[model samples]
Target: MERRSHIYGVMGEFATPEQLTHAVEKVREAGYRRLDAYAPFPVEGLSQALGLKRNLVPLITLLGGLAGGVGGFGFQYWVAAITYPMNIGGRPLNSWPAFIPVTFELTILGASLAAVFGMLALNKLPQPHHPVFNVHRFSHASADRFFLCIEARDPKFHLADTARLLQSLHAHHVSEVSDD
Candidate 1:
């Protein structure tokens, strides 16, 4: 049996957003996946460089709202007609008009709950740790500095070769992004 060596991601630091964006494109063209760019402010071409498709947040929100509406309608119908029925002034036992307000409120409530939970889950919130945090210079990510990190998890990742590739991309500085 043979053992494989672990390879981690490489981090390229940049002084300007332009350099970061350009380097990102070079990285993508170099045929690397599992890379992410970070900057204090959003850049125009950053998302395209990272090859991110549309976010699933909206889809989750929509599904949640649909479920909420259906649940609201079903619950009201069951309670009014099946659970307990009453006749007032010979009116129909299933009083649709009076139940409308409750149904509407419940729909809104359920949708709101779904939106909150869905957003959190989609964003993978409560993640207090990340390998990028190990880089002391990463704090600058929230400042004026911009960076692109190529994760070792990529299929083509090779430790020295990846670092060399970033260097060839004219990155200001390249360093290993480590989890340890």
Candidate 2:
């Protein structure tokens, strides 16, 4: 068996979302950037309280769509105009209007794919485990409880002071989380 010695962070269990939100706000105000919140359901305004910035998934999706559109049109144009050209019935080989459907379909496909993959990548999904799971109380996070955690890696994170702050914020329980 491997001996675990590293501390991941300190976690506070709250009875309500409001308390959890307040704790996050206060922790942020105290200059702790490495913090996260969890609740059984979505908590309104929690993202703002955490001071999270806008994500880049939209831009990524747009770029993917544009690339797909250009690629689709270029490929069609190359095939019709250069690769296997046939001027049938006095009609032009490079028909821009004819490629609209395939281009549009490819654009939608690219955007949808980019949105899915980009969101997963940005959120770092597929993780088998996280250090917070070490706290047995965290299981309630998927139920009725709310939680706030301040990582030890934060510059302003002092274990004693952070625990005291959480206690002052009306946490039901405060515990240390070990990164085993």
Candidate 3:
């Protein structure tokens, strides 16, 4: 196994959603721009508190749809009229009407594919390992607990200072999370 230095980060475990929300707000106001929050369920205003902007899901879908439309139409046009022209019923090889169905199908197919794949890529899915998981208490986060983990890699992070900040935010416990 390849061994690497452990990267430690401050983590604030909150017992309640309200504490998590309030902690998030204070963390932001404290100028720690790289903090994150976790809860059993979505917490209102948490995104705003973390200064997260709107996602690019819509933009990705739009571009994917455009590419699919153009690709489907272009491919069909080429195969039917240019590459291997097939003429039936004396209807021109470039029969756009015949291509409509495939083109439409491809447009929808591409948009759906992009929405799923793009979201996964953007969110960095398939991460089998994460430093937060190192915290034994973190499993509870998926249940009734709420958590906020600020990575040590954050520009403003200083081991002691970050932990102190988390404590000041009234977290139940501010533990150091290590990427092992």
1-87 in candidate 1: lDDT tens per residue? 111334358898888888888888888888887899989998998888778889877677677777777777788778767887666
User: Pairing residues by index, what is the TM-score of model 2?
Assistant: 0.90
Candidate with better lDDT, 1 vs 3: 3
Backbone clashes for every candidate come to 0, 0, 0
TM-score, candidate number 3: 0.86
**Candidate 1 displacement at residue 14 in angstroms:** 2.1
Q: What value does the lDDT take at residue 30 in candidate 1? A: 84
lDDT of each residue in 102-155, candidate 2, tens digit only: 999999988889999999999899787999999999999999999999888887
Model 2, which residues run further than 4 Å from truth? 1-5
* Residue pairs with backbone overlap in model 1: none
Question: After aligning candidate 1 to the native by TM-score, how far in Å is the CA of 38 from where it should be?
Answer: 2.0
Q: After superposition, how far is residue 177 of candidate 1 from its true place, in Å?
A: 1.4
- Candidate whose lDDT is highest: 2
Alpha-carbon runs more than 4 Å astray in model 3: 1-7
The superposed Cα distance between candidate 2 and the true structure at residue 104, in angstroms, equals: 0.8
Q: Rate the local accuracy (lDDT) of all candidates.
A: 0.79, 0.90, 0.85
List clashing residue pairs in candidate 2. Answer: none
Which prediction has more favorable lDDT, 1 or 2? 2
**On a 0 to 100 scale, what is the lDDT of residue 104 in model 3?**
96
